[model samples]
Target: MTFEWGDLFAGRISGMAASEIRELLKLIDRPEIISFAGGIPDPDLFPSAAMARAYEKIFQSNAGAGGALQYTISEGYTPLREWILGYMEGKGVRLGLDEVLVTSGSQQALDFIGKLLIGPGDLVAVTKPTYLGALQAFSPYEPRYVSIAMDDEGPVLADLEAALAARPKFLYLVPDFQNPNGVTVSADRREAIVALCAAAGVAIVEDAAYAELRYDGEALPSLAAIDAARNGGRPATVIHCGSFSKTVVPALRVGWVSAPRDVVNRLVLMKQAADLHTSTINQMVLHDVVSQIFEPHVKRLRVAYKERRDAMLAALDAHMPKGVTWTRPQGGMFVWIELAPGRCGVALLERAIKEANVAFVPGAAFFADRSGANTLRLSFSATKPDRIREGVRRIAGLLETVEA
Candidate 1:
């Protein structure tokens, strides 16, 4: 008889599955595949030179090296948290150091929030076709999900109001150029949504991973910012998860969470228990880099990514059949596509890779209710504009073949 490790696994393990996009990303290594499956940053855009200098400066100083190499506090480096406070204040949300936590990445922040708030059969609200990573993080904790359907202006107000009526423990959303779908919630809707959730005594977890990557439209205030306004610039309902991965680089895995002091305190304890804090050296290096060039670096990314986005939209328009439709995102890494009736995204992905040497993520993975069979997500962030055009053309050609 085989030694069954499954018998000894935690019950939560049963709810976790390998990420669908992560698996598809493996095809990118083959060289022949034009993969748009993962919404990862382009390596070329990473501030490799700045990062090298930051590390060199750290090690050159004996005092800096000693502290960096040593384990640090779970609450994260104080100076970094201070920087976060300033950044949040810029967005009209005021935060104290005690209300901040430096997480390994925003992904960890989501997991911590899930563990903090979710219990077996607890109700959680999520946008329809939400971030797959969030669903993955929360699933292990075993909360049932109620999904709010989204329109171009963001989650439909009627749907959100209905979801809130169920008395969920929290509502999770990516307000700024949401993942899988590139829709940003309008300013007025943000206000209405904040007020509704606050009134219902429901917490909001705002994932701002792609907030700084906008290419069009004026920047809107975050949910935290609006909620803070309700209570004299203090966090009232929103827990914001922010990341440097989209703007800077992902390898260092630096992200942060800001919430009310008590919530942050609990998360800090969880952080201490999970890994005894993020890498001290990495945190210091990240702090140094962002402090020096965060804005200019993000500006550069916006330009480069915007070109690729235009190329993808153009290619889709030029090649796709009339029945096919896709969203024109103002910012972020993804373009969401919806096929005509009776079509399937998964089937199209299989045929695209096999016959056209292209790759993308089927949108059903992002749906907590598992309903988006004809929808898919394409990422233009990593590929060059020419390659993005080629990839979209190939996928469109393949899609046509399937229709025939």
Candidate 2:
């Protein structure tokens, strides 16, 4: 007799679904398709030489390959933790080594946060069109989401105040160049949000995955930075998650959570329970590479990604049909487009891939409440300037017929 696997599965598995971007990636791998479906860093810009040198150094170290392959503490490798501390200090958060815990990626940090704070049916607050990956991470815990409406400057204060009344476990935000929509929360809005959440005794979960990938404008203070300033350089109200994926390389799978020690201590236990810590060799290589060329590598990315961004915007301006509007992101990979009323982004994506040989993520996937049917997100991070222009033009050409 066959057993029913579904019956044995956890109930939380029901809330989890496959990522749309991941699904789209499978379809867009053909050379004929000009795809903007994935918000990923371009591999051509990766610091391959530096990374190779890093791996070489690991073997040449006094401890040799055995030590490199050996398990590290759940808290993470020491030199990497020290580097993270200094990086946080540069950003004004002033985190000590104990306050930081390295995870496999920021995605893991989010999952841990969900496990730590969300009870079944607990309240979780997210931006109206927030990152889909965050929703996927938090959904496994089965929290009821309260979507906060946002303006160009970020979350609306009145809406956030109303959301605060319900007392969500945390206000999750991608404050700097937010994913999908690419709207950076203004400095004033960030401070106000930090203050409002702190006043309500709510926690703020800050996802800064794209913070280092800024292509234009001065960087605004992060939610964690604002909260730290208010609490005298201690992480009081915000649990900040940062990633090396967008900055250095995604394959290394290195990222971290910077918070108060107590919270980190709890997460460290969870880290131990989950995977017994991130790969020791990967962390060692990441530390070596970052120590050598982190800043200059990031600078090169900004320049290349900025060109792609400009190309996509210019193509949209020149080719997009009437009744379309998109966000002018200060610095990020995405450009969010709102099609003329009654045009669903999903339908457009279907036609775009089949007919126009182009693809993008439908905006509805990014919504917690599953709103924004007429919107879509196009990513410029992974494509070259020419390909970006061609993809935008193709999408725009499709919109002309669909919108009409």
Model 1 regions more than 4 Å off: none
Per-residue lDDT of candidate 1, residues 19-101 (tens digit): 99999989979899999999999998899999999999999989989999999999998889899999999999998889999
RMSD, model 2, all Cα superposed?
1.0
- Which tens-of-lDDT digit does each residue in 71-105 have in candidate 2? 88999999999999999988889888889999999
| Top lDDT model | 1
Displacement of residue 20 (Cα, Å) in model 2 is 0.3
Clashing pairs in 1: none
Let me know the TM-score candidate 2 reaches against the reference structure: 0.98
